[model samples]
Target chain A: MTAVASGGRVGDGSVAMLRQMIRIRRFEERCVELYSRGDIRGFLHLAIGEEACAVGVTEALDTDDAVVATYREHGHALARGLSMGAVMAELEGKVEGCSRGRGGSMHLFDAPTRFYGGNAIVAGGLPLAVGLALADRMNGRERVTACFFGDGAVAEGEFHECLNLASLWHLPVLFCCENNLYAMGTALRLTESETDLSLKAASYRIPSWEVDGMDVRAVREAAARAVEAIRSGGGPHFLEMRTYRFRAHSMYDPDRYRQKDEIESWKQHDPIPTLSEALLAEGVLTAADLVSMEEAVDAEVDDAVSFAESGTIEPVEDLERFVTTPAPADADGGRRS
Target chain B: MTTVTFRDALREALREALRSDDRVFLMGEDVGRYGGCYAVSLGLLEEFGPERIRDTPLSESAFVGAGIGAALGGMRPIVEIMTVNFSLLALDQIVNNAASLLYMSGGQFNVPLVIRMTTGAGRQLGAQHSHSLEGWYAHIPGLRILTPATHADARGMLRPALADPDPVLIFEHGSLYNVRGELDDHAGPVDLDHAAVRRPGRDVTLIAYGGTLRVALEAADRLSGAGVEAEVVDLRTLRPLDTATLLDSVARTHRAVVVDEGWRSGSISAEISARITEEAFYDLDAPVGRVCSAEVPMPYARHLEEAALPRAEDVIAAVGRLGGCGGSDG
Candidate 1:
């Protein structure tokens, strides 16, 4: 008999996974609120509908594994165990922020988790991930680098170049493509002449799998397989997790680009409620238990907000503190020895 | 002790790095079976195998970004850009990502990656292939720029660069590849933070690097014959520049002349000259002068290319204008 019957593995991990996904959902809702209030500057690209893909894939990774992400990464950073307070503070550009006010909303970074970056450039993180995997191979490390990009990145030249190098050298990398069916205003079909993204990957002989990102269990299963292959020295594996974002590409997007009915349609298959209902059907949780979980996550998010708000602004004199290390001389020359 | 060409010295550096540390590896276009664009990586694949000696597709951004990633992932990657001219393709990675990662991550990551590329004008490769952008890279922080002028530096700098905690760009003058020099099996460690005096004299200081170093030395010899003693300083490290050596030489000679192969406007020469004026303005008796290439695309014609670049004649004239006394050796 399966432990949870939610088509997932047994025991405490099941609960922990639920909590992780809840953390992302609740965290993003708070980010949206904060952005509207003018607390978090710059554009916010919340991964509301896509939380499962970020949490599930990152959960399968070891702390040593490097993570390279794109603009829409509040979920990934939270899933990687970056403090929710620091993430919020970074979004608020406070002194307690992970990047210390250097990289705002779109660029969340944590060193201890080995989170390499929150690079906003499209398809820019691909090569960095490939290189990181190459480093692991050369150093004889069994670690895998988890690179997360969107369907939009598959069209970039770095995508092709990275795939060729990763497969050619058999470097350990997990190529996680979150295909949400849209690249900013343009749909995937509009941007790519060839709509089969995995075909782009297969051209380099990389084995790939597709999963329903709206289903947590499905994402977990697909991610587990890809992660297992990479950790077990199976070379690089690709996954095209079909996902959708509940929000605009960014805060500035009028979203006249996408239809509201399509947005409402994705909400019907939303990962959070969809998974919760699945858990309820399996008798893993009740309406009351789910309500309690939601309350707990909401409280945690509130505490993070208060912490971020109470945090002080980094002194203007100390603004360029970590800009270089031993940190002397920043690009703007704010760093003083 | 064995005598090797400048390119062989570079290959030797790669071989030594690969054998000594598992973290070190080579990646670039045609670096594997082709044995490097300039044959500097010749005979490496046979020894280290294809795993260590990798060949990349013609994607500078992806491969260069991957090199930065590999460094963050804990490998000491040496990414060759085929030529510095082609480095523009991956300029985003070098300037934006690699140069900013350590500080941007709040000191969480240090790239420790070495990017090697052929630079300077020599071969009549025309407008695109004959430009030097080392000065552009040197302008950034979180990066150390090394211009390997001598065969020794070409062989020696890679070890220290691989050992440094930050990313380093090793600019090997394309023309210096064939220049041969004898070296002992064990070469001593050279500091990457200071400039070194290549030829000592008294009346004036001749400062240059990369392919221009030879021209500076030749100009010094010409000055000596013309009764003007010139001190030649080779700036091996461009960023966190060797201002100490440059200033001390100027203090002794009371005159300075910089020879740079980059364009005249907003070039490495401009930065060096500005720094000298800022730090050693009182020590100089006369205004510091510079001989830089014409501010235009490098023409492919042999005579035209020579006229467009810094030469001994140009440097000799610049030094003479800087008020170098006849053979006044200090």
Candidate 2:
């Protein structure tokens, strides 16, 4: 894992990481166009600048380990192995979607890969992640539950509660805080009395660190270290990814809260270009290699769009389904009706 | 049959659940070293140890959400909130996550979690510790709401609830903990559906559940001496309000009075009365009646607390308001 770290020799692993960031960026770029055409509806939260946080943390997790992510989690879902087609189909509210169109943009779920959800509510997934780790611990299974949330969730009571519980119970949880400055319109400094996010985790007596989120290699390295410590029975770990969202909080948000210069400054550190340039400078990635990667990502994104376009919506008659598990036949005879 | 208190019945049920399934463990505040807030889990800590009989911090949202997550991770978890009042802290997790998970996840994730909490106003516990909000929880889908009034149900409901693929909320009335009744020694898992006809009659139907079941039964006994043979119906499941049994009993009696510990407005009693009117309009000899608690936060004073709650006298008065049994011919 260290071999793929920044300043280390770039290899196939590093290139794959670069490719993942491009895939996420291209996918969400396509989503913006689809959203304009009204192909995707409801609140669309893009993780345009937070791809490193998603890909870095996710790549460090095992297939069997669980992941609980926020609404801005298209990158996490894609990196966790949910097909682009399935995610795109979900955004379009199609039956072929990952959640069968029940959970659109904010609630993507895939069971096989152990992806828990695309939770819409801030700080909502923290408790779920704690419980997942508790289950793994009680069952004697060595599995880490990586929970991703934004800076907004740090102010939530669930965040503090979950941190204490996870640490107290010695549960295997990797708390990935994507601290992309503003929690919606309110900046972190305004909401939090103490702006240092890692210090909050440290107060819970849990090991915490801050990483440059724009550097995918740094995120992956930090996440790997945290996941390793948790799996080795060292309890929960927290990594505050210092990043920024280049886009608005949602499609509905005008994003007037932050200045243009600030946005442009963050864009200068965009993860995709940062890693690509670093690899190019190190003679690890050629111009031809970068072009091929972009071409492949575009093709994949194009195919996903087509898949979403061809997908069908679920029937209205089945609307009442999944409200509750179907009651067993022998249990309540002639009672429910 | 052996005589037992409702508290012991609940403990036995918890013990049975813990013994039956390795995945099932009880997690709550004071459930371990401190026993339980109501002593419902008295000696189980020594029997099961800290791993199984886990005591958690006073973090309702975190533990409850963890229970849901554990359920998703293929473990059946029983999370006990000290009281329904305290459960408000975890309302978001319960409503948004536990109840919405199955439907929101496209049936891919089912939270097989059982959340047990004590409800009802009594013992002068004041405003925070009192109040019945099971009706509020009943409005949500993807979750099962159970209110066990009888010793048998208190001893039986947990098994099936743990077996349920979806989330189940068991609202145990705080006042009914000491109520003694004969529970069968072999009482196992009871069905999580339908209401039980505790007492049968033809004149009028007295509907109730949880803490109000005893009140309705007492009212029925008094009505018998007055030549008004009131039938007593115990609504076991609150969510999927056994409409069939409720409508069946209402159709037979023709006159009905709903007794609820919750308030009258937007109450479970209101829902029952409306359902009877909607489904069995012609069967009714008169309009449905209701007996409910006074609309005020439970006061610490015993007199005010008792007055605020529905008693047998209130049930009798409500039944009287429904008019005499003229048998639809009237």
Candidate 3:
């Protein structure tokens, strides 16, 4: 793990991180193609330039650690080990999807991976994360609940309430604010009176810091430290990841909010190529290795698309199935229906 | 049977829930040190300690959403909102998260949370505190809405509500806390999915719940005095409404009058009236009548507040308008 933090080994771990980022980048790129083809519908929020934060922060979490993410969470879900097939199937509205097709792009959920949701509401997941951490603390479990929300969520009242409650109770929560500059076309500067997002968490007495979100290593180091501190009973910690979104807020967004030149400027710091170049400079991965990784991701993305294309739509007879549990109390370990 | 006030029965239910399950915990404002706003959780804090009987800050959205999260995390949480008015602050959590999670997540998550709030107007607490918003909550599909109008139900409903895997909202009428009655000694977890025929008759049906159940009962007595045999139906559950029992009563009575503390426009009472006309239109001898709160903010003046809320006399008057007072079918 220190290799990940101290840049000691640009070995399998480093290559794996870059590979994960590339996988997400390629998967969402395919999603864009699919969206244009009418194979995927609903609001699709791509994590194009923001892959580093998802990869680095999620890698710091333990297997049992819980994650609650925002709508722009295809990268987070992928980095957390949710199957590409399931995510794609969910995007395709197939029953084989992660949430059984109930939640499409904005609500991807994986119970086995401990991914709570892809919450579309700006700050809705914050309180849920606080409660999850409260559960861990009360149950004598040393697990961190990492909550990922955008800068837009900072303006929501739940953000203030959740931060205060988490700090007040000494709950183990990693408050990761993905400061992607704009919140659904509303720039952070225009909406917030004081734009220093870390101060919001500081107001609740929680220790906070900032990380260059475009740099995977910075995000990993900060998240690792925060997760370690929380697991050691240090209560909640906050990290404001300074990042940017190269894509529109959603598929329907024309992205007229920013200049095209600004996107190209941010593209110079793209996490995928930047990390790839770092790995190449360290002699951890050859140019051939990078080509092979991209090709592998391409094959994987194709398989996922095929899986999604062939996936079945949940029958209308089961329309009301998951709304309430269908299992009888006697059939399923006293689980109420 | 043990005689107790509505407050004591609720306290006993909380005590039982805590004693029975290790995973069960209660959290809200003033629930611990302040012994709850209306004394429903008076001594439970000392009994269960601060861990189980959590006294939260006035952060309703966080606490309530935490309740949903805790339920998702495999803990049973009973979140107390001081009253229905304050619950508006946490409405997003309730409506968006608690109510929608299970359905939206394709059934991977079900919020096994119970939110209890005092509702309805009678104490003249003014426009802010006095309003029946339970009808608003009942409109959501995933939530189970309960309104216990009896001491037995007050003592028993919490258990089954806790046993439920979905989010259940229990609206405790603020005005009924001091109302005393005998809770059956054998009372246990009661069904949270049905209505009860409190007083059975054949001339007309008076449907009411929560704070207005007593009003409907009194109106039935008044109708009996005037030679009209009126049946009284106590709708214990507002959502997944017990349409069967209501239709049965309506079928027998042939006339219906709905009494509600919420405003008449788009209220749960309006839903019931429409349902009766839709499901049992042929059985009705006249148009369904309603005695609902006036569509005005509840005022602080006692007279104005009383006028704004539904009263037994109002129920009688509404029934009288249905031509049921003379013991002869119209």
Best by lDDT: 2
Off by over 4 Å in 1: A1-15, A312-337, B1-3, B323-330
**Candidate 1 local lDDT, A1-337, one digit each (tens):** 1445354433425555677789998888877777788887787887888988988888788888888898898888988999999988888888788877678877778888878778878888888888888877777788888899999998887788889888987889899999999988899988889999888888898888788888777777788788888888888999989999988888888889788899999899988777777667777777887788888888889989998999988767665555455533343442421
Count of steric clashes across candidates, in order: 6, 0, 0
For all candidates in order, the CA lDDT equals 0.84, 0.91, 0.91
Evaluated on chain B only, candidate 3 has a TM-score of: 0.98
Question: lDDT value for candidate 3?
Answer: 0.91
| lDDT computed for candidate 1 | 0.84
C-alpha displacement of B227 in model 1, angstroms? 2.2
Question: Could you give candidate 1's per-residue lDDT for residues B1-330 as a string of tens digits?
Answer: 889888988888888899999878898999989988999998999999887888888989988998898888778889999898899999888877888876676666778899999998989999888898888887887788999888778878999999877788999889989998887788645678778899999988899999999999998888888788889999998887878889999999888888988887888889888988999999887888999889889999999998999989988877766653665432
Pairs with steric clashes in candidate 1: A127-B66, A131-B66, A131-B70, A132-B69, A132-B70, B227-B327
| C-alpha DockQ of every model | 0.53, 0.74, 0.64
* Candidate 2 Cα outliers beyond 4 Å, as residue runs: A1-12, A327-337, B326-330
What are the models' TM-scores?
Answer: 0.92, 0.97, 0.97
Off by over 4 Å in 3: A1-12, A329-337, B328-330
Docking class of 2: medium
Provide i-RMS per model in Å. Answer: 2.2, 1.5, 2.0
